[model samples]
Target: MSDLARPRRSVLYMPGAKARALEKARGLPADSLILDLEDAVGPTEKEAARELVVQTLKEGGFGLREVTVRVNGLDTEWGEADIRAIAAMGPDAIVVPKVNAPADLHAVERLMDDAGAPAATKIWAMMETPIGILNAREIAAATPRLACFVMGTNDLVKELGALHTEGRAEVMTSLGWCLLAARAHGLAILDGVYNAYQDEAGNRAACRLGREMGFDGKTLIHPAQLDIANAEFGPSEADVELAKRQVAAFEETRAKGEAVAVVDGKIVENLHVETAKKLIAQAEAIAKMQAG
Candidate 1:
């Protein structure tokens, strides 16, 4: 599958400080795994977690799951070492925290290059700070190696001094801005984590909202949230059937010198056909990944 279309429906953050969590992550149903070394690891365990994450990357039993490591911000004491070590090991990408501008990505790219990281190793920016949201476009277009955006809504709420209300009104603008930037640059973007992991109804509602908002997927805190995200983001059986019918109808109409077709009493234009094709492709990619 193309990097842009890779199924990231459920990206789970595994605490790098916990050896058992690292081991258990291998069999998790998440489409992507973020071996987190930033907020997930306490200050005292930073170095130890870094070492463990590096070793885990080297060991390599993650099957077809997209593996990434969330490194500390470059402003932090451990950020430089974290990037250098992670870049060399070369997970799918290095998740950089608190990216406030293009220059932040430039700095991370330089460190990655300096460490001789592979070309396939990309950067996932955490879009959390107010400055980051304000400069979302510039940051999205910052580097060719930057492949995805992961929303840091928890920190965003804290930064904005806003409460986490239902529907996430507090951080909606931030999310939308980063989303526009990500889509404008043709990069994949994931929604922020849902804090109330145990609340299945709330979690499902949040997942639905994220999918409706055009997120490729959502960052999750626990394995229990994986199925919710995957079901919400991945094309369902009904969706696949409708996409197939739409594509077939559109092709038939086009062959007859027509510009559009009707599907379930709604006009399906070229743009709709395009979206249907993409959905079909994404569904196929997800199936292939799971089958493998």
Candidate 2:
């Protein structure tokens, strides 16, 4: 964790080649905009897309939302150019797809260093493949520069040969592993994009499930998914109230020199207090953003 606190409830991916979409995203509610040069760009257009991405970054008009460039796999020809352009332009972060080992992070870090990228420029990994899930912990623990993990549920589903059930039961194991790895490293982890953009009910269901599964946010393919993602990730009024109550109770006990506190007939530990404080802080931030 870079101690750079960002609310990434909704991350929307835009094709790096589409200048119009890039411009239009400035008004969207997405917390992050990913200029995608990987899956979105065609083979013939990869170089052109990289140029457009560089131009967009150089122009510098994306509002408060975080901007990330999703480069092609490091093994590909376009990947080198993508990395070079991104390093030169220097967005908030570079998202590397299909990262399976610590070596991948090392390679990227070296490239970034060679490019003389700022230390503030962070790396976010997409854990999609089988090898990636298996080695996620090692990969996450590999670098202090790693900030977050974005799940590629669609790719993982394909690799595992599993169907997307109503409740996402098939991908539960991999999802759990991703959350565990992220928590172990104290990094933010986002759920993969829900492909059914037109299906509002399906999108909300998936977003709710992701929140229940402890994801910090969900990656989105469409701008329409932004509101639902944001709403799902934000703490509810009841939740904020409960968290405040827990904190108050814990503080009252601490004032009396007591180590342990009981809240709502349940034991509240230091971990619980920390969680409550985080929730309150997030809630306040979201409220302030909404107010403005």
Candidate 3:
């Protein structure tokens, strides 16, 4: 969807140590699940969580799900072992925390290769630090194996000493730059989690804003936010209908030796047609994903 490998409209973070939560995630409607071993797991429980996450990936029951493990950083006590274990038991990707530079990605790539991980083991960078956001473009262009950019807004906010407002005014500039970098290199970018799990309306508004800002999806903290995130990020019925009409009109005009067409009094050009086609394709992809 949206030229991304999958529709990440609702990416939920499931605790790596919690068996019940991981089991519950299989039934949730989220597009992807991040089996988090970094922030979610306590220091003492890291080893157990790491082992459990690997076992879950090996067991593999979450159908049509892009399962990934959010590994601890290489700087941590359990980081290297976590990466080695996860690399061996590859999921869809291995999400590393606090990736600040291209060198960081290169280091992980070397580790993954050394571990003899499968070819499909992707690398997802958590853009949380100030340096990461500053070097967003370099980090994105660092490796072909990098697949997605997950906004770690909580850490960023803490780093910047900024408040997480209802509209996310403070972090908009950083988000914009990071998004530009991701798009420049053709990688999917996901908005960070909405901390207000109890506030459904707020979460819905945030998801809408994320979609408008051109994020491929939004990371979620709870199952309750799944529906709202999916709906808000998805193409509306009206949008799909309009895209179809525009594409039809453009094709007809092209056949008549025209460079542009007018659909419903709006000028439709090649760029518009391209956008329309992507929307249509994404809608179809989402429908197929849901049906299965």
- The candidate that achieves the highest lDDT relative to the unseen native structure: 1
lDDT of 1 by residue, 123-222 (tens): 9999999999999999999999999999999999999999999879998889888899999999999999999999999999999999999999999999
TM-scores for all candidates: the values are 0.98, 0.93, 0.97
Higher-TM-score candidate among 1 and 2? 1
Give the runs in model 3 whose Cα sits over 4 Å from its true position: 1-5
What is residue 238's positional error in candidate 2, in angstroms?
2.7
lDDT (C-alpha) at residue 198 in model 1: 97
In order of lDDT, best first, we have: 1, 3, 2
**Pairs of colliding residues, candidate 3:** none
> Each candidate: RMSD to true structure?
0.8, 2.0, 1.4
Considering summed lDDT, which 10 consecutive residues are worst modelled in model 1? 283-292
Q: Summarize candidate 3's per-residue lDDT along 65-161 as a digit string, tens digits.
A: 7888899999999988998899999788999899999998888888899898888889999999999999999999999889999999999999999
lDDT, candidate 2, 128-243, per-residue tens? 99999999889889888899999998999999998989888988988999899999998999999899898989999999999888998999999888889998998889989989
At residue 6, give the lDDT of candidate 1: 92
Q: For model 2, which pairs clash? A: none
